[model samples]
Target chain A: MSLIIKDLYARVKDGAEILKGVNLNIPKGEVHAIMGPNGSGKSTLSKVLCGHPDYEVTGGSAEMDGQDLFSLSVDERSRAGLFLAFQYPVEVPGVSNANFMRAALQARLPKEEELDAVAFYKNLRARMKQLGMDPKFTARAVNEGFSGGEKKRNDVLQMMMLDPTYAILDETDSGLDVDALRIVSEGVNAMRAPYRSFLVITHYKRLLDYIRPDVVHVLYNGRIVKTAGYDLVDYIEEHGFDFVKEEHP
Target chain B: MDTPAFNDADELSGKLRLALEQAEAEARLREAETPDRLNEDWRFGRPHIYAKALVSALESDTDNAGRITIQAPAACVEPMADDMRDGEMRLRSIGSDKILALHLKRFGKGICLCIDTVLADPIIITYETEGVFTPSTIILAAEGAAARIIERHIVRGSGLLVATRDIKAMAGADISLELEVSGESTSGSDQPRAMNITNIAAMDAQVRQLTRYSGLDWAREETVAEILHENTTIELFSANRLHGTQILDQHTRQIHSWGKSTSNLLYKNVVDGSATATFAGNIYVAPGAHETDAYQANRNMLLSEDATINSLPGLEILADKVRCSHGSASAPMDEEQLFYLLSRGIPRHDAQMLVADGFLADAVTQFRGSESDGNNTKI
Candidate 1:
């Protein structure tokens, strides 16, 4: 089983098309990394998967685990095990991080089940200590006034807490330092399992060195132009998108 | 006309009777016409809209030893006739507003709060009332005395409430005064209510004032203060939330009478449903009051298209070498922030509240000592 997108086409509400005729399949239990240049629709693909209201899907379809993903709302898509870690996480100024996480976890539970405050805090503090995050952040507003590195780590913390079956990290390593990168990678690796999958979208090859994607794809011009193993990373590091364009053309 | 300040009054003390008679005569002789759309300040506040309602006095506690909390060293606790105090409430709250005159002619007994030592814990005065409740208080902080006083009122039912609090801080006194008012619909249609607050600061005194008003139906609150001495500082914050057919009119004034003094005011409003909220903040710096710093701001958010908010920030500065600034903003919720929360699997209504909590975060943070309570509040 896999998340399959066939000929996906999307555009801004009134602007020019951003995603045009894209095809990709991320099979369960396999980690895939998509690297691309600027304006390659990497962020758009992630947003569309979560049903962002600003973008409209003009044609084609996407399905996850044999269920039509397009039929669900943004929140439903999340409860259906699809997750997108934002590149620029928005600040919810008054909501505490603890409360936000609690609401998110509560949303995932059955309707009659109430969230246990004690267990929730116990698990939250444990994960926070593991991520090297100060416990004070648990009471602070969600990503409000956080530094660039802090925001990225917060994104990873969210991903870890939710534990979605299929997760996409949209440029999660762009603004991170070397130390932050290693810490974030460890957080991701701790969540890696046979039943769960990850689609890592980044611009640099350095992030792949830590997460170690099993399959690598070159997403060029809103389409997966070439697919290979880790060797494609070496080729890109040497010749860049120039050779990918030559091969696809 | 609209609701009468009072329908009729029972027997009163001879002194209070004389003051009421004189105030009634003066109010009638110089009766200002109902400020309709013609007056600039009354553009959003149509004082002509009147509804008839009953009025009565709220029973007072005979022994208030339990009510008056002196967290600091004890000084004096006394109650007096306070006859002329009610008559002055009219001009003290807002010179142009005539509604307070009607209140003075009816009810007139209040409490005087005085502290002589620095307080480690906040002094809380809590009250619950029904019917037409008229409660008044005066706070006095002696020199070098530091204290935090909170007056909280929770009221229910359809009746008018006339409240007045006069505060004074002497030299070197650090004082904080907080007024938290909440009203609920208990029975019938909720009637209009009026509140008046005034504060004065002496030389070298630092005073911070906060007022949190939430209403169902209709409420009118007037908060005003003046820096009377040199080298003093004052800060004022207001937060309001209204729903249903509530109509709220808030008037605030900051006056700097001496140079080398600073006064700041910030007001935030959130109106939902078919409610209407109005805010008017005025800052005045007297001539020759050099080096005076005055600032005022009003921010409003409407939860629905039908809701309305009117904000006016006024500044009158005649002194040179003075710094003054004022701003007012009225807008809806930020859609981008809303989308971000919804994508996290939060329900639609919960997401709306979260964004609202964020919009009012700045004002919430200013509530001193509230953060240490360990309660998760998205205020």
Candidate 2:
């Protein structure tokens, strides 16, 4: 079982293609890091996987365990065990965090069944503690008037609560401070299991130090030019992406 | 068998005389028979009906009574000797369609209760009348000072009550009025009340008012405000809640005669059961009142299968360089908002209540914290 991106092509708005031809397989029990410079389609891949309405998938298919994820709506893809930790999470005014999470959880229940409130809160509090979030955050409106680090940490909180089979985290570490990033990385690592996987997208190699990935991919101009192991992240850190840009061209 | 065509003053005098005679005759009839829901005039909605013996029972008990409290200026204590002038008012038993008339027997010529800012408490007026018709009248005078008044009318059993009020907000004065109506199930009758508020605002004077009515079998509250100066400002807010087959008919007319005058009117109604609520507001900017700014809005919410709301918000502008607009909208509760709340585990009824409370909260907030004259009101 894996998240297979087969000959995937995507465009931003009505512009020319961003993700020209992306092909990757994130197998279960693995953590994959896709590192690239700005505007290299790293974020585009996450949006395409989540079936964002703004992006057009010109050609390609994304399959999770042989079921096409690209064929589903944004919410449907989320229900089908695909999660995207947005770089900038949306602020929904007057909707409390607990209520929003409850809606997301309720969407997963069977037609006749319901989630137990007691169990839901119990699990939610435990997950929140792991992410270093204050208990009071549950009552506040979702992501409203939050600082940069707080919003990033909140994204991790949603990711942990959702517990999807395959998660695409786009720049989840950009705005987080050292402590917040470490805590958020720890929360992500805790969700790692034999049947779950993650594709962490980042511009810098800083986050990889906390949650080591099983595979590393370097992207240049909307294409993955190199694929290696943990050592590739160290190479990209020691030497910047200039060499990669040269290799892709 | 025919009458001659009279001049303007003569015709007006005849009309005034006829109106007073009709009012007195209706008042006498109201003292006798209790009005019921089946009465032709009450074909819309009816209040509670209490037998004449019930008034004696209520008077003897002295325990539970309908309460009303007024707050006004110190000069109100002096007897309004000149207020009974002829041709100043033309009203008759409120109206036959709504409330009946009853007698008010205990009042001296110079009995004036104090309702100054120092009192700081609701001057409650209680009535324990059990008869078919319970007619009551209170003459309020706010002579150049500002105040807030909360007038509450409640009934225990079904009975018709026709009430009248005369308020004078004199030159450079302000007044805020809050009218609340709520009661338990009583036999059906009509509750009609007429308020004639005369405002003589000098240069740069202001007046503001809010009337809130809730929980009555049937209510028809009417008001007429005349602005009598330049640079005068007036605002009127009306909120009504109706349940069962209750019908609420509210009519308001605002007249502005001076330049640079401003007036705003807003009405909100929530109707359930087969209840019906109608709002008719007319704003008149006279010929000489240039630079007049007036606006009116009427909004209604229907909660049940048979509820109805009718709105007629009108504006007449006779002056140049005036900005006047009025709008009315009637809509059901937002189903998408309800679904969004319910999907998050909030029960359907609670969600609807939250939405309804949000819809009405803005109108209620205007009544708190301060009086209409920009002075802080003592709690």
Which regions of candidate 2 deviate over 4 angstroms? A1-249, B1-144, B186-205, B369-373, B376-379
Q: Pick the candidate with the highest DockQ.
A: 1
Instruction: Please list the C-alpha lDDT of all candidates, in the order they appear.
Output: 0.75, 0.65
Task: Give TM-score, chain B, model 1.
Answer: 0.80
Backbone clashes for every candidate come to 1, 17
Candidate 2 per-residue C-alpha lDDT over A1-249 given as tens digits, one digit per residue, 9 for 90 to 100: 999988889997788899988999999989999998788899888878876656899998889989988776566677778777778776544456887787678767886989788998998899888888898989776676888888888777877777788888888998899999999998888889998999999877789998889999987787788999999998988898889877766
Off by over 4 Å in 1: A247-249, B1-35, B50-77, B83-91, B191-194, B197-202, B369-379
User: What lDDT would candidate 1 get against the real structure?
Assistant: 0.75
TM-scores of the candidates in the order shown: 0.88, 0.53
